[model samples]
Target chain A: MQENKHIIELKYLSKYYKGSNVPAIDNINLNIDKGEIYGLLGPNGAGKTTTISILCGLFGPTSGNVFIDGMEFQHSAEKIKSIIGVVPQEIALYPSLTAKENLTFFGHLYGLKGKHLKTRIDECLELFGLEKNANRRIKTFSGGMKRRINLIAGILHKPKIIYLDEPTVGIDVQSRKVILEHLKNINKEGTTIIYTSHYMEEAENFCSRVAIIDKGKILTEGKPKELITAKGEYTDLESIFLNITGRALRDE
Target chain B: MLRLLSSIYKELLVLIRDRAGLAILFIMPLVLILIMTVIQDATFRTVKEVNISMILVNNDKDSLGEAISEGLYASDFFQIVEEINGEKITEENAKELVARGDYKIGIIIPERATEAIRGNVNALINKSFKSFNIPGVKKRTKKSTIDITIYIDPATSNSFKNMVMSSLKEFTSQLEIEMFFKNFSEAMAQLMPDQKPIKFDSFETIRYKEVYASTTENEILPNSVQHNVPAWTMFAMFFIVLPLAGNIIKERDDGSAFRLKTMPGSFVTVMFSKIFVFLGVSFVQFILMLLVGVYIMPALGLPQLEIGPHKIALAVMALSSGLAATGYGVAIGTIATTHEQAATFGAVSIIIFAALGGIWVPVYVMPHTIRIISQFSPLHWGLNGFYDIFLRGGDLMVVLAEAGKLLTFFVIMLGVAIVYNNYNKTK
Candidate 1:
């Protein structure tokens, strides 16, 4: 109420899917500041995707208020969407389309067009080291190239907030490094990055502040180093994660 | 606006790249129109131009048999075969030929059929003279009833049998009337002895003239090309459901749909883009089908498809039908959970609708229940709209009635898709 400076704020958020007795995400509160890299780490079925989905405005929470850049989703849905870019875990680009074509199409969805859209597409392809393969169909690309193109599509409109779900999953070291490097550069440009990952070490090093979430509840939230130091006998974020969420199988 | 256009352009690019989908969209329908037109052309000719074969055994080579043979020969409907293997066909042989399906009908005139008819007429005339108490009127006994046996193939349709029977009845009635008039004139001359014989001219009191029921001055008769062109075109237009629905399912499965949901503006932009693109595909399909109907069908020795002068009506009908098909595809895509489900249901459902809509067979020939159900099919409405223009010479107002139904179907299907999509999301 006192002019909250955070770029994103979630208040008592919960989601109970239809016909399910358990809530996917229950009574969660979170705050992500501008230009900060925030990682949400969780085990399988731990509600990471659900929380991200709600934040992306993919679906409304069962009971909660979501505010993005000081505006509520109810009143500023389009405005919020325009400012937020989403890179889903899946290779979201059309397989039959060339990398440039896929990028141009996504750019147009964000209202970018003509020479501007073309120039942006070319720049992204060049930065991703995919300029040579820009004309190649996505179906013809390797998994890493596809993942890179997927990332480029999300950031083509130069959004202020980027929500990435497992963006580095199932990709090679070279593609992952290039992607993380570019994402860091984008963050340096004052874009708030909210990312989810199963990689604990990566999250520990990459995220400025992190939240360990499981069973629809946030277990802890703080800077990675501070969190590591506070939790005695745990050397790194992986041990901290295993200790908190446990090593038991969450086959779901 | 740019988003819609860009999305439409994207969908077109994707569609153009899919060779299999392109073939299903263009080649399948063109080949279907050609093949179906060629196949149905024969059936149509059977009704219009081709003659039905009949076996004739004339035991009485007198007036009745000669008259019947001459009448059958004169009419263009029948090709009478009087012999087989250079041997005269007997009554039993004619029946066997008809029963074995070698011919559609067989006619056998009984022996002395003309004499029997003459004797009966003479007896009736003598009885009339006796009733009037004319002098020297001799009483005469009526002859046995003359039976002209007709053998009809069991496989022949009842309607065809009725037509053949009616034609035969007309011939026999004329012959009987002629015989009666001749006998009466002879008896009158004998009774009067001084009066000249009266000559009766064969003049039909009422004549039947066949013409197509149409609104235009120049009527285009319904033929195979006219029927198959629009029927299969509508079928092909609706067949867009397969590729369109498959595209949607692929987007959802691959997560592009989710990404789109997270994009600027509403997802309706994307759905509308698909609709716009696929609707254009449907139009292209319709046009190609018409071209095949007009040119290719005629080249294949089938009657030319006569699309009436109502160009605006035809365009309106095509647009509405295309929209309806696209809308259905979207609805199926939204409702189905997987590509297999969408493709199978889309294809089977379109075929079912086409069948019900009289694509495979005309609605008039369908059973009462199916015919009633056909009224509900979008293809039926589209086919009727085309028929109204092509065959019935209907104006814009008449086609609008059908186009309105098709557009309503489009709106309803779109609404269902939207509602289902939202429901799935919320759930």
Candidate 2:
């Protein structure tokens, strides 16, 4: 039943760091279909970033195999990487480079070049309202502006799959709205996205499906409303997340 | 390949826009060459006072010849080249030795030089007393004169020539006084018992009949500009570590390197791009510094730096030195965690290396221990390569060891950098 429907599959995924008894991510198994906005929701230290990082092949899981588009990460990393993009939680843009230059470099990295990449860059910048400051160095931009440029850098190639680790993190509501709307529009165009967020309300509204995780293990997995109804008498996703992952602050 | 090109292109763009960095790379070296040339070359130093080697051929074998030979052998200034055959060196052979190149000055003493000087003194005594009709002095007088021949290669420096000629005046003056005193002592003995009277040492007896046999190749001698140009240029090339390391550390801290990892290419591609960009920058630096040394220094009233006969050797040595410096830059980039850490660590360590390698001073001036110490420095290898071609007129084969050593150092350092980077970074 899962064949041909799921684009990403993780089998018994586990990651145990050196000198630590507990695993960072333990015995995880999941499958997400293509063209769906799948969210990995958790509090801090919930392994949301770690799962996304591994999915992007940032590092290997201690004991597991990840298959994306029917190609294993270990065997076909180059192919899988070419079709995927990652927007990390940290601002990954070069401060010395202008927004346009940064985008152009990322485009060339993904084998996009010539006038085609240029036109695509212009369209993306215009859509994000960053065309006005395309030539300004990222160091001169505001926090919100830098975040938007960072987002633009990841999508420059228009990858088939994008993994965003908190795309709207630490920005004003205006910048947040612009970023979320663009993401939704891209998703509507049939690109699969794996999004990790601590914002329960946003994930409930945005994700077609989500897995609530805690202590490196998934507690529940389903549609937000279904999971909300199933877990006790919680009326909303945020209360359900709190009741599941607990009110205690988890730090890595 | 296109990704590599784009990455290198971006690195070049960033480097070009760094005005302060470019100024340090270009202007500091050129300006330092000028300043050092003015200070190190302005003072006049004697050739013999600074360890000059010459061939000495003495057929006199007398006290005079012995005195001159001993002077050279004992003085720290002159280094005498002893003939291996033990045969008395002829004037012709001495000139040939000087002409062959490394030795610029040759000394040859003719036979009977002391006898000729003694005879001339007696004749002068007889003539002085001719007006008084001194019979015995006139009867004992013999007429002869000493002629000291100096065969020098015309290519010898004016200062060395002057130094050689200045010694001639001293020989003549000292001999003349001895001859005069000897004649007077003998004249006084005629009035006494003739029992080996109170006579001073004879001037003609201890006098040296020596002159430059001829000049040889003076091209190998290093002047101010030749010395300062290469030393300061290589020193400046290594300073690239500052900007290079700063770029690396900044990218790592700002998360650009991590982003690059998740992009299209492998880790090797990005690393190769950075190293290639640095190599290009170093090459440009080498060319610019050479232009200043070979062309600009002369226009500014300084001695023009020589590229010697083999221009290809110069080019090869320059490339090797640049690559070695860049390799060091790569290694420093990996080890340093912060910009300040990278900059200061590289700066201080290189400065120490330069100091210990005799870059700031001529290796000849270094003591035996320091000379041994200098052999371990990569800067010393590069400086030796430059010196071989610039000062020693060494061919490619002659300079191959220095260049090879530098290239080997480049390989080792580059290997360490790559492995260290691979270890720190996730695959």
Candidate 3:
């Protein structure tokens, strides 16, 4: 089922950082398909960021291969980058700029310009309910506003696949709802979604399929309902997650 | 094309948003230039009269000696402090006083000096009677025992020494001329033998106008206060703009820059656009400084600068050097890891360049090794360009060498920045 339907494939992907005691990310195999919200669920230090950063073409893997839309990382870095959008763990908006200006800048970075760029920015601002505060500086904005703008910056290019790293980490409930709703709409519109989060309930409802990972390796993965039902006597996705990834807190 | 637009657009947006950083970068330099100009104007005053207080040791007890001392004391030029008569003046005390700059001129008079000027009866008779063996003529009677010493102090007063010397020479010449005329009249009356002692009443009054010439090329000194202040103003502007160019690097470290890097355009295009922005900033800083120098300063007793076409050329050459240096500074700033490091590097490097380039001091006066070191600094070129304009009144051709050096610095620094960025991205 994974091999026939997958749009993104990672095969024997292993990363051993320079002069490190152990691999930052161990051998991991996974597949993500188009029009599906796939969640990589993990606690802290689970190599979630490393995996996302590598897939974004920041660097190459120590060994094995990562294929995006069947194009290998070795040859099609630029093409893959063009088709993919990344919303980083950090709020990547410039604090000095107005909310609208941040989006405009990001929009232009995605090759959207002139009146077309201006229209796209206004649309995104309206969509995020930030139309009134478009002219306000980002530094003066609330965390939720910055988070929304950060999300908007990544999606302005309208890539086929979007990768979001803990987009709701510090956002308010209302802002989180807006972000997940936007992600749902994007996924519905034929864009494959790859997300990482510590929130179990959000992954349970929002993600079509989920994988529990710990210590840089995947423990289990399946459709949320299927994983919950298959694990005997589990009432919800959290019970399934707790039984698999454990209840222990990860500390640096 | 789209990628280039995005890169440039992102840079413009960030620059606009970061007002605090931009303000410090732009207006702070202007304010600093203004403050420094005021301070430098205060410290570097025009070279004028050196005042010396001299103790006049007059031993001439006669009326004539008294008149000489009184004349010198009464004059508006010589500042004379009369010493109380006690012991004879010694060379040791005189040297100490002169070395300390306590006095301008020291006068020593030997005892029994009044007898030297007296014309003896025998001397007069020898001239009248045509006799070789007159008592006063034959006996070398009382060899004029006049020993006088005038110790002039060079440190305390250059002009005061000249003033006192002029007064002394004038007094002696006037007394000799009067004596010579008195003797001539007597001789004429004796020759005529019948005519009453020639009573020719004639008055010849010559009018002399006093002129105080301001050195005017006669003195081969350093440039007058007029040229040096403006030259330094330009230098200060160049240095003050150096630290602000690190915005490029600051943005890069902050993540928004990475977002821009991945924008649809070439990275080099974006870098070049930032260079243009900083160049504009440098231009504004230069103009503001020049305005203060050319208009506001001369009104306050600084040099009257009448700039011609050559001055404009030199100014442009200076501006070009500033642009090149600014370009280099921006490149260096981007290569740095943090804003603090970038700022520190920018400031320290500019200061080093300023020192090496003879902005702090003239290269001509620097040692050979230091002068050789100055060739590596863009600041030297900038200052030299300024010198060519205001000091030498030189054309573009005169500043071409300096401009070329600045261009080379710009190229090297820019090349290093480009290489560093490429290497850093992978790291």
Highest DockQ: give the candidate number.
1
Model 3, B13-92: lDDT tens digits are 66666678678756776566556555654434312322335666666776446756777676655556554376544555
What DockQ, between 0 and 1, does each candidate earn? 0.75, 0.45, 0.29
Error of 3 at B350 (Å): 1.8
Q: Residue-wise lDDT of candidate 2 within B225-270, one digit each (tens)?
A: 7777788778888887777778777777877777777776656677
Better of 2 and 3 by TM-score: 2
RMSD of 2: 12.7
- Model 3 misses residue B115 by how many Å? 15
By TM-score, how accurate is candidate 1?
Answer: 0.93
True contacts kept of 2: 0.63
Best prediction by lDDT: 1
Better of 1 and 2 by lDDT: 1
The best candidate in terms of TM-score: 1
Candidate achieving higher DockQ, 2 or 3: 2
Return the candidate ranking by DockQ, descending: 1, 2, 3
Candidate 3: residue pairs that collide = B3-B264, B3-B265, B4-B265
- Please state the Cα-based DockQ of model 1 relative to the true two-chain complex: 0.75
